[model samples]
Target: MRYLSVLLLSLLPLLAQAVEVGERLAPWTLLDQFDQAYSLDDQTRTLLVARGMDGAKLVKEALQDRPKGYLEARHTVFVADIQRMPALIAKMFAIPAMRDYNYRVLLDRDARVATRYAGAEDKVLWLQLDNGRLVAQQEYATAAALREALEKAPH
Candidate 1:
């Protein structure tokens, strides 16, 4: 019983992670490094939410180059697949400082599924971004796809 209790306690926080695929997640609830809240409404122009480190890295690199009409300045959100093998992911996070790079780790229990959302394995993904009044929607092949699209979008 004691062992079961300890195990349950350890797993409780993991189970409580709020990220969900295809489910509408509020911008306000997403926690940043300091545990502060950022909402979609807070984004003045573009909001980039990538599922994996590669995607975020590429997008950040592209942003650094300052693509035309698409201001490099934007809200960047990163979601990590936390439920997978711990060592592999731990190394991934350790090598690159996610927080220092202006990226926020997404709290998702299903890392594999979240990877799919980040457009991992070359599969296309549908991203739903709610911009206060009008709903902005787009499909992305990879991180660059949506970044390019948002750069050209009127709103």
Candidate 2:
């Protein structure tokens, strides 16, 4: 019994960070590009969580050529890690440009949301969650590969 307890205790940290394919994501709320509140808990459609600035740019470029209707039809959200940026810089530059994005751009101010999905800050964390549960979590080295992965995901 003591050994079992020790094992369980050792696994606690991993459990906190683990977002397995069949499991539900940790509930989170974030401000969108328009400074409006958005929550993963409210989404009934597939939620896609991408990583940081580069990830966001890659996703934008990859979907740039797709039809507007098709892009609008997808339930995708980009999570940007803006924790390191100065407040003035974000307000002056980032926020305005973010407002122009055609799709929803969620701000992960503290990076807590991004850390819950994946550990890597630089790589694109392509997560597909249904209703709330994660269906797939893929890491891609390139934008084209990321787009291909999304295209092949079960709709």
Candidate 3:
């Protein structure tokens, strides 16, 4: 019983940051891959948050065909959560890639923002928000499914 209690207590902080459906996302400010400032306020009418590397890769793969202008025109924001990476590695590879990358990739450095949306790692969290209020969320098992959903979603 004592061990269970301790375990539960240890998870309390994680539980506190969970983002629920139908709730407005908590305000967040993070850096883009280029190390530029990107905030929740800077997001679009529809936001797609990828929780970890797998999620980011999925999101990238799903949107492979779309050009930067198309994404910008659609008012869609793609956030890449890189909080799981070591600080040194992030500084080395992750941050530097942004300099040449065309698309915007928001780097959730501490992952606090990502944890607020999804506690798990390596899964994409598709969140559609309007004026900062969450309207929908779903987990995709395949890139094709995610692509179809994004194609069908209201822009």
lDDT of 3 by residue, 1-155 (tens): 99999999998766675666678887878777766787786356666777777877777778777766555666776777777789898788767865555578877777667667763455677777777888777777667887888778665
Which pairs clash in model 2? none
- Give the clash count for each candidate: 2, 0, 0
Q: Which stretches of candidate 1 lie over 4 Å from their true place?
A: 1-28, 39-47, 65-81, 85-96, 103-136, 142-144, 153-155
Error of 3 at 52 (Å): 1.9
Q: Could you give the candidate ranking by lDDT, starting with the highest?
A: 3, 2, 1
The TM-score values for the models, in the order shown, are 0.44, 0.75, 0.80
The true-versus-predicted C-alpha distance at residue 107 of model 1, in Å, is: 4.3
In model 1, the number of clashes is 2
Residues 78-150, candidate 2, lDDT per residue (tens digit)?
Answer: 6777877788999999888877666677788886887676545556776766778887676766778877866
Best by lDDT: 3
lDDT of each: 0.46, 0.70, 0.72
Ranked candidates, highest TM-score first:
3, 2, 1
Better of 1 and 2 by TM-score: 2
* Model 3: colliding residue pairs: none
Q: How well does candidate 3 match the true structure in TM-score terms?
A: 0.80
Preferred candidate (lDDT higher): 2 or 3? 3
TM-score attained by model 1: 0.44
